[model samples]
Target: MNPTKNSKRKTGRVFDPDATFLSNHPRLSIMILLFLYTVFLIVPSLLYTLFVTPIFYATHLYLLHIINFFSVAILWSIIVPLVLGLPNKREFIEYAKDIKIARIKPVLRSIGLGIITAFITLTCMLFANFLSSLLTGGQVQFVPQLLIHPGTTNIYTSLLLGIWEEVAFRGVMLVLILKIRSKRFSIISNGLLFGAFHSVNILSGFLGAILFGVEYNREHFIPVLFQIVYTAMLGTFLAYMFVKTKMLLPCIIAHYLIDALNTLVILNTEQLNWAYFCFMTFVGIGFLPMIINIPLVRSFSFWFPEPDDEIIPFFDTFLVRKQRLKQYKSDIRSA
Candidate 1:
């Protein structure tokens, strides 16, 4: 044997030494798992709120509160971890140890990005509103119900929902998809899915979704803190962070801050001046930078290197090797 070839073989480590259990077609598995999980998590929660909670609570508000708590507990504690095979508490703690919180630059960059992204998001909304008005041939009337409802309670609720949604969609789903496809593919796919998920809103959901997709795709800065702050910008940033960092804590914190801020804004409309509204509108349009530059960025392609391909499938490979090793050991024992 050639000495160089022998040395190279000796230097190489075993792939997926832990023998983690993963699917061969990981992307398909993840999509299927997510769909099934959503059905299982949502149906029961909805039924409980509609049929069971209402019996006791009576009012829609009270019933909604009950459902919220129930969904949180079931989804966070039971469903997410068990069904999805998500990181356990112990594993999360270990992962946190590896994370260096001192890397605050990304977080700061994310704050900037958030502000710009928010501006762009607002701009899109205004643009959409204008388009909607032109199509209708009338001035768009602002419904007081839309404005007045969901006070402090709504803000807190939105924060919680934002965090959970980010963790599940971006953290779990996006990360899982990255295990099978390219990082770019994972980000865009997750972003589109995240955006589509928001279509239920009817008013700003589509625009919001597209913006969120963009945020997920751009992962140059620190994935953890930066992504979370970005999430604060439009509620979709944390989802983006989840995909980039594959961590939950920062995403939750960023989500909480953004929601809390929105809640404050929503609750204090009387205090807001025309300038504030104008500023928000301007910021919403900030996403245009990313939108226009995306093609150029893809063509340049420096942030993500090709060598990361093997590492991209880390989780999937671990699972397959683990299963194979177990089977091999069993066979040996039997022989």
Candidate 2:
């Protein structure tokens, strides 16, 4: 049965049946999005383990990183749009707007916010490390890594990841959820899914360890679990940022900065213990952002968009008044 027959609205933009169907069946859309994303990540990782790593080994391992860069770009930047049925520029532009990457003003504001978040996250991390050192009687060591010090490949990878991940999680997935649910639900679900998505990395890591004949212990497993938890928290925070700011740029910037900074800063953990790791991962990087987001979520002054608010294409317009739109559609059906 054609579901799009009665789904028309006077929004005066392109009417895509696929988009309509996805909108109508939010669970199906989310599943498709997650399925596509997971397949790309897992397949490539397996390919790398089975093919690339054996050949590259150690010296040429940088090749895998380069491949990863192109793979992510292709998946999120190219394949996703095609899957969403955006076959042309105009349709793609509208999709971009839905993802909160269209307008310049909000993007600029996003950049500022991204910088602030990065600063706050880094400060918390450093402070956590210092406290860890103090309690454990370990000397705090600060080392600044340069872009070209070891190689520029990792730097590029970090930046590429920052952009593409936001595009996928916040831009695509979060927007999809927002279309069908409350803002709070969207942010929380997006964050949780985003964190769960990273669980694929644990599998990849295990495969790598197996390939190398290395014994995987709880030390490795536990850290990966911690990573998943912290990333979930971080994802939720980023989701909140995307919802509040209505732009993807800030999240991209923040994601990139945090990854890049973590890579560049080599903290000394010789005298530190699990307490340090737990505090830094759970409290500093995780809960801190969530704590910061609480106040913004509570503020209801400009919470939902009015009917007359300048429509920024799909996401914001449809999301802010989703209930009202449902009623409007119901009224139309009755009429």
Candidate 3:
């Protein structure tokens, strides 16, 4: 079937089918996108776990960190784009063009925002640690991590991750979702999938993803830096940077800085406990808009005695309006 020709408008729900790229074959588009991302992630992981790790273990030629770097670059960046871009060469070419650092204005803005977020993150960490220490009667102690691995491991790995992860998640996966579904669907799916992709820090990842989506929507998805502090999380900050600048440089730099900061911190049980609590708090705050977004949630909407306005009506556009008009006309004809 000619999916485009047969595309039908959607109404009465968060997901509007008609506004999507492949509205008539939503399922197929979703399957393809998921399959591509899955293959990219799985192939690299398998190659590392099965081949590279064993070779490193036996020969000790290269370290685990190097292996991880190559694996992520190959699977996440090199392989995924090559494999996915093959059939849709022209589309990818255009995507490559659109995905870049745009200009001086947004780049400066994003970098500043990233620095602020880093400071905020640091403050959050110290505050949480102090509160935890108080509760634990000053039992907390910073156990220095043995620098057994290569000293440059975190630096290189973080740099690689910042670059490739943005390329993979924001450049490739998010674009794929936007093409297949409405902006809301794309942002939500992109955010959730991005979180799931990390898997190491699922809650933080999820919160970061949602914040990224919200920022993109807030900016009207025009790739503009509309706000200074979009979302406080490092990952979300990266995503917002991408949206504003349309360039990966700011995102990569910010992302690397955030992860690189991790090298400076010491790990402890009490700190983790308080950090987790804080993480939950941030996520809860991010989702608070849902009180008005979802009518059901508004039933007992906590802070807002009167929910001010709709959360994200950004998805509504001329295309959706036209589709709705067509549907209205069709309904009258049927009657």
Candidate 4:
């Protein structure tokens, strides 16, 4: 029996479907746009920071600081979003439909997940720091800074870094790549990209990025809120916000809060205790709700009926036949 002539079986799902590509080529158009925009914004700003800023700062440090601050804000709030389509309002609202607070339960549930995620993240970081110390012959350092100091260059730098990174990795890269691939593939690819992008910070940043990717894929709401608790925790949070809220605004806000807190804490304190351990433990306990909800997430797959045992004509567009079991039941009830 010819497979194409068979009336019952459904067509094979597209792995890397032709429709996935915007153009008839290997490179996705959006990826190209992202690369170009990154170069255009980053190169000139770096040049100004290294070369031009020095000339002015040699004469007046205060003026130099002001210029750098404004430069960062402009880059984050204006330049990046304009160049890349981020924080799509329509997409954000649609994704938000999945989230609703009928009672306090959902909110509490999300908060619990946030807590668990925070604990796991801190535990991982501690282990990573210990390993690094053993390998590098240096004192292991794992501190959490909780606030940004007023009138400091570090604040601006952190802000710009957070904003640009969220825009690039979550808003642009993840969205564009996912548009061309399956959800699972896109999630994994985005996770890898998230981790690789932080290579400059070595193992600590890399590990952090991976966790962020995992949390983002698991639950989209609490991650954003969780990110506001710490700057180092921003990656996963922002990514989740991008996925769930589909808006860059929440991401930007989350990133800002995290970085601002870090800047404040680092400037005032010389050392931080392992209260991070306790914090993570508390958060990990909170993630219990999501752990319980896993079965529910899986159960959604069985709601659809099996496809009919007949070959269907291709209508130029791929369309899955709607399962009419509920409607059929309603009609029978009426009769």
Candidate 5:
């Protein structure tokens, strides 16, 4: 009996010498994946908030944002793929497909579809912000800090943020979860995790208050909580877009535009209270985008074929159910 064949039959998965040990253990791999991703993403900002910004003094905020951009880009774009043993072109392509970033056939059509989605989402976002401002009796004012700051930090940071986040959450996390669960489960799980990810801001605020004497109070908490909830819903939409488009670019572009616009303007109001927060969280971030983008994404389907939801790749083997493994071993023994 061939040992490798016997092993494959028992496990129901072809053995890959290069696959990481953790990849075979789904639960542990997931915990490690989230831990590492979160550490890399939040640590830089946290450190800056706690220590580096205070010491450096000038160019502090700019440096912090730049550091964040580089840290996120390097981790997701370069390090993760290399760690996954995707050195070969074909292997990398397969990895990309699994994550829904593959250059699907008819590349031009895909690019056009992505751009259209971005345009519609951005327009809707602006309208939502405007309506939110009007209803709250607030004025959307230019963010004076970003506007007065030197260089194009806002632009580049927004662009990189969009790329890094969509690639990390929608491209990678959502895809991995989808492999192991149903689409609804994967999408909702991703959204909740994404929402929880924003909770780090509370920590950052607390650190700032402790170290630099910045005020951290209930008012601050409210905004952070609102951000957590809003981003959660936004994450769900972004994941849906990835599913509908079968490409990651649309999500990235939409996220970038949203971030860039946010950096430009903020809702300013004399009546800054809980009522404002509640309205923004539920109506502005929640209901507004849903009303806007559903038709736009669907209308474009006729222009080109929607990519099938099926995502078969070697990673699927790593995520096999325990019952399947048991069945495979029992069949092999009987045979």
Candidate 6:
């Protein structure tokens, strides 16, 4: 084939959404359109809340899992490419490379961090319980009934759920939002989404979600355990570690450990009593890193990540967004 003939031939791959009818802010439109994907997770959950258990009794169908399965599909297959709009196979390949999926160093480091993260979370919670007992005369019992046996099925399911939730929220959703929004915006919004990911307005979830938002400006993404001022502060530390090292595997590891153990804790909450919750209210000191890095944090606000001095070659989701942002700027200019 002649070069000229081949050049003229159209591969016809890109979606190339028509720009003529779009508003002045095409990117905003894309953002809003992508936001609707939340409904895919939410509505099914609402249905489950309303009818799943009763229907199971009536028809004996394992219908509850449908919501879970759909949630996974929406996160991986749909939301992962929510903004790209019909990109070809090559585009996705490039995207994976851009996100540093091929890089192994940070991942290994993240795994290591995860081990430490679990201990940190456990210490915080246990210390909270201990303090609660000392301050308010609360009975801290190692009651066998309180600690549910860690069944294999339950552990596996919880771990699997943790991985999926991380992949969806931090992995895909964070990357997508970073394209058009600032890093802080991406972190905060996704953190809130992380909180709301439970399909309800849970306070601890909300705190946990925002905990990591403060670290994005440094161009690192972190994952962590739980909520409240106590959980939030702990989350802040976990997020800070990820940002400093540009490793995420640790966060994911920390996530499942916290989730699995926390489930046992939640069940035994009443036994430990409300005094325990009140005891945990004294707050945690996880944000000491920021205080130590105080000068850097002075100019920063809640959503902004404190800038760090170290320059590292590690590539993670934040870098992926930087690439996307660069590309978006080019598109906006051309338009």
The lDDT leader among the candidates is: 2
Q: What is the lDDT of residue 40 in candidate 6?
A: 54
lDDT of each: 0.43, 0.68, 0.45, 0.40, 0.65, 0.45
Which has the higher TM-score value, candidate number 3 or candidate number 4? Answer: 3
Which residue segments of model 6 deviate by more than 4 Å? 1-38, 48-66, 82-90, 95-102, 106-108, 141-154, 176-199, 202-242, 265-275, 278-335
Model 5 TM-score on a 0 to 1 scale: 0.73
Q: Write the residue-wise lDDT of candidate 4 on 1-335 in tens digits.
A: 78665643423222333222332221354456445544544444345445654446356544444554555445434543443223222222221221111112233333443343334343444443444445445464433332323344345555665555665566556655554465555545665555444433333233434533433232333333333333333343444434543345444544454344332222122333233333332332123322332333234223322332111233111223223655677889999
Q: Tens digits of per-residue lDDT for model 5 on 184-246?
A: 677778888888888977877786688777778787887898889878887877787777677
lDDT by residue for model 2 over 83-156, one digit each (tens)?
55422222554566667676435334546667878877877777777777777766566455554333442456
Ranking by TM-score: 2, 5, 3, 6, 1, 4
TM-score of 6: 0.52
Q: What is the lDDT of residue 5 in candidate 6?
A: 71
Off by over 4 Å in 5: 1-19, 25-27, 46-55, 84-93, 104-136, 142-153, 304-335
- TM-score of predicted structure 3: 0.52
lDDT of 3 by residue, 1-335 (tens): 87775574333233444233332343454457556555554455445445544445445423555655666666544444345442123232333443442222333544664455445554555454556555555443443352233443355556666667777666655555444455555555555555545433333233435533433232232211211111223334344444534455555665566456544444355322443344323432123222222332123123222221212233224336767999999999999
* Local accuracy of candidate 6 as per-residue lDDT tens digits, 28-51: 433553455455545654566455
| TM-score, cand. 4 vs. native | 0.42
Model 3 lDDT on a 0 to 1 scale: 0.45
Clashing pairs in 6: 110-250
- Which structure among the candidates has the greatest TM-score? 2
Each prediction's TM-score against the native?
0.50, 0.76, 0.52, 0.42, 0.73, 0.52
The residue ranges of model 2 lying beyond 4 angstroms of the native Cα positions read 1-20, 52-55, 86-90, 146-154, 270-272, 293-335
